[model samples]
Target: MITGYVIARKPMYDFSDVIIGRNSLLRIEDKYYHGIDRLNWIDVESRFKQSAIPENLLNVYTDLEASEQDLTGIKVLKKYDEAVVLMSLDEEMTLKNEILVIASNKLNQIKGHGIATVQTITWLGYDIVLLGGWSLIRHAIFENRQMSLLKVIALNSFGLLDNEEQADDFLKQYNKLADLDSVDPLLDNSSYGVDCIRVGVL
Candidate 1:
């Protein structure tokens, strides 16, 4: 029943013709992270552990916010780089028969902003698709035909494997599309990317 949306914006800044300003990049990063943190707190408190929000997840989000501030203080020398902002909400309550009024209200806030939409496709499988913006041009999940199952594996963090052999067994299902250039053979056929990694565990 985990679900949410993400928004990405390109910061508008002007710098000298030859070099881009560091302060501009910092400002954009600050705004982006701030938005993400705000959405995370709202979602966690209102849904995930509504009965009793865990202090650990709260603390981790706080720490991440602080780190983003530190990142803003650093100087940047690049001009034409892409910056991304993501916000997500996951709740078990949605599985219940009763619909969550509060969660619905919060979702309405993101309407028409070109954020990515997340939804359940099966009892234990979920699908996340980007839309309405440049972000949609890229596929967040793997593109291979057999690797469609990899989406489920990645969403569950490869839960099917307890040891290397088990992981290899799972990988065997998608051997045709696996990347073989890596030193580790198991990684050869995997398509998990940096964006899918969960930031905080609750």
Candidate 2:
């Protein structure tokens, strides 16, 4: 896992695809390659499953805790004393971004001040959603906290194909590149082609 501490807050950048790609690179130890691959997704998922519910972090800030709040149009997938995990319930097939933000705000308000530090993670069921321009992975990275991790799972050739008919052709190209151990070149110097992308702040 890429580990680093937040020394100071940096100015938030304007929302853009490039910013998301850069943050995705920060999750890995490398800073040069702002791209991702299958192995990177596995690593990121492992980290999330391992650290999804922090056990010791709550103790560090005794004054901050969670409280009972009415959350409508959202489902609580995981509930813990220190954290409440939520998933979208809308039938529109996209995450209700405001619900997560509202939950975070409620958690912050529980402390009666701005002492609570809230972080969010979003998982997209369809790999094609990454190109939808509405995915929350980018917001989870730069907008939530100074240091954060963003993880996304994309399908094989999902990023390169323009339509379903091109799947076969793109898959062949991707496979050939993978065989040559030069898959990064197929990414077009971006993280979009990777099966998974992870950006984290420890």
Candidate 3:
């Protein structure tokens, strides 16, 4: 079992509820930040740049409505809702020596649980782009049900760190290595250029 903090950012769609449906991903959960979860530093013009996020607080702030104030980040949005998930992974379910993260826009679908044929639709390098305030890097697919939630934020967001110093410090302390070219036979398909996780029978 591999344990870590996963922060997910969904850029395109706004969902009312985020459901976890996979067994490979266990202990699906999230954290609540009272005063720290404010969208004070989010700006529309600041595209391609990382936003200011307080420590230990997942930055779920999305700049959907630029003029709206106190709009409850990820709580309620006129257009869409963004969220972050934290959970664990069962390595035995993954392709040996390969770590896969899935970011899907689906609000009620997940990868099918149990051993089956999992294919890699594409390769999203560690330096992933951040369209929304954050990114979810866990694996989502076309399936019916299961458990777990590992947040995978945008690579550019660097876990939504405030500055270069913090980002660099984060890189230095990080030690997990995922093979971008590995062939995983029992994983979910990863979609590119869009946040889409389809649920299909395996």
lDDT of each residue in 1-202, candidate 2, tens digit only: 1111111111121123434425532232331221111121122123335664245443422222112132211112122222222111222211211221112222223223333223443321221112212222222222222121211222222221122343344345444544565432233432233222222221
Give the Å error, residue 56, model 1: 20
Q: What is the C-alpha RMSD of each candidate to the true structure, in Å?
A: 18.2, 17.2, 20.4
TM-scores, each model vs. reference = 0.17, 0.21, 0.17
lDDT of each: 0.24, 0.25, 0.23
Q: Give stretches of model 2 more than 4 Å off.
A: 1-85, 88-160, 184-202
Using alpha carbons, what is the TM-score of model 1? 0.17
Evaluated against the true structure, the overall lDDT of model 1 is 0.24
Location of the lowest summed lDDT over 10 successive residues in candidate 2: 1-10
> What is the per-residue lDDT of model 1 for residues 45-139, given as tens digits with 9 covering 90 to 100?
34334545345445444433343242221111111111111122233322211111011121222321222224322221112211111110012
Misplaced by over 4 Å in model 1 are 1-143, 147-165, 179-200
